[model samples]
Target: MWQFLKTWYHRLASPKWFYHTSGRWLPYLAAVTILLLVSGAIWGLGFAPEDARQGNSYRIIYIHVPVSVLALVGYYLMAVAGAIALIWKIKLADMVMVSAAPLGAVLTFLALLTGSIWGKPTWGTYWEWDARITSMLVLLFLYLGVLALSRAFTSRDTAYKACAILSLVGTVNIPIIYKSVDWWYTLHQPATIKLTGGSTIHPAMFKPLLVMIIGFYCFYALVLILNTRAEILRREQRSAWVRELI
Candidate 1:
């Protein structure tokens, strides 16, 4: 079993092999993402019960919470990809990191926008300088910085290294974003649904929240796969495999 696993791992380390394997999963992931997102949106927006405090306005949580969560996760993914590219000199890893940046930025922007919309009704204001919100804004800027720096250099190698370093440095902001509410006084509420401890939200709201979270993950997977495939094609355009596939 160990030998077989090691062989498979080595195969996956090859860009051509990884591309072919990813191709097999792409359609399925895309389909599942669409299905889950549509279903979750319909259920959450139309069928879910209104919040006791915020009423119908809280329905935005379906979008806001999911995007917010994905923004953080996406950054970590980009950072890990950057590290792998820098340490192992994997060209594909660098491509993945580069491809992930724009998507992460979009997600972060959506989170901030939706949060602002949600806030107007709940907090009686469109924006606040709360720690979590401020940290997320910083995260958005970090993502932009990585993207900008990656393209700033004429040499792809130099650009990749610079972006990787930026990603690693930006990772510090993620923890600050997560712990902002806990570590400091802030208007943003504490986590309502605790995975290990206890949940403050009732089961009715919790169910849709879970569904939306799953839907968001599926959406991210779908987008990442598409973006990564495009990156591979762009970077490997002159390669025999890409030529043959194209």
Candidate 2:
């Protein structure tokens, strides 16, 4: 099993191997992503019981929570990819890192946007400089910084190195973001979904939320694979395999 796993890891590090393999999996992945997102949206928005306090306005949690969770997760993935590229000098890792930056930025933006929308009703304000909100805003800027650095250099290697260093440095903020509400007085609510202690949300609402989270995971993976494939092609355009595949 270890041998098989090691072999697959090496295979996954290969650009041509990933491009062809991911292409075959795209259709099935897209199908599952669409199914989960649509069903989860319908269930959460239309069928789930209303929040006693916020009423139907709470329905936005279906989108807000999932994207928020994945935005954090995506940054972790990006930083890990950057680390791998920097340490192992893996070209495919650089591709994955580059592909993840914009997607993470967009997801972070959506999380902030949805949080603002949710806040107006709950907090009586559209925005606040509270700890959680402020930290999340910093997260968005970190993503933007990585994106900008990735494009700032003329040499691809230099750009990748710069982005990788920035990504690694930015990871320090993630834990702060997670713990912001706990560490300070904040309007942003403490996490209701706990991995170790189980969730505080009612089962009726939590069920669709769980589905939406899973759906967002799939969506993130689908988009990442698609973006990485494009990046692989762009970087490998002069290679014989890419030319023939094209």
Candidate 3:
């Protein structure tokens, strides 16, 4: 079993293998992303009960929470890829790290945007320098910083090392973002989903939230696969395999 798992890891570590395999997965992932997103949107927006206080405005959580969660998760992916590239000197890992940065930034932006939209009605303001939101904004800048650092260098190797170090260093803020509401007085509420206990949301609402989260994950995977594939093609354009395919 260990041998088989090791072999599988080696295969996945190859960019050519990953590119070809991901082509086969693209269709299936796209279908699942569409199905789950459409179903979750309908269920969360139309069927879920309105909040007693926030009312219809609470429906934004379906979009806001998922994007926000994935934004944080996406940063971790970039950091991990950067770490792998640094440790192994894997070109493929560097590509993955670079590909993930823009997406992470975009997700962070959406989270902040949706959160702002949700906030206007709930907090009587469009923007606030609250702890959670401030940390999240910092998260966006971190992603952008990785991206800018990558391009700033003319040498690809130098860029990879710099981005990897920056990504690893920036991870300090993630815990800060997670603990911000608990540590500080803020309008942003603590997480409804808990690690030690069941979620605080009602069953009716929780089910759709769960579905939306799953949908967002599927969507993120699909986008990442596509992004990686594009990067592979661009970087390997002169290679025989890419040339043959082209």
Candidate 3 clashes between residue pairs 3 or more apart in a chain or in different chains: none
Question: On residues 55-84, what C-alpha lDDT tens digit does candidate 1 reach at each position?
Answer: 899899889889999999999999999999
User: What is candidate 3's lDDT per residue for 162-218, written digit by digit as tens?
Assistant: 999999999999999988989997799888888788777888998988899999999
Give candidate 3's whole-model lDDT. Answer: 0.92
How are the candidates ranked when ordered by lDDT, highest leading? 2, 3, 1
As a whole number from 0 to 100, the lDDT of residue 159 in candidate 1 is: 98
Which portions of model 2 miss their true places by more than 4 Å? 1-6
Tens-digit lDDT string for candidate 2 (113-192) = 99999999898999999998888899999999999998899999899999999999999999998888889966988898
CA lDDT scores, all candidates in order: 0.89, 0.94, 0.92
How far does residue 46 in candidate 2 sit from its true spot (Å)? 0.9
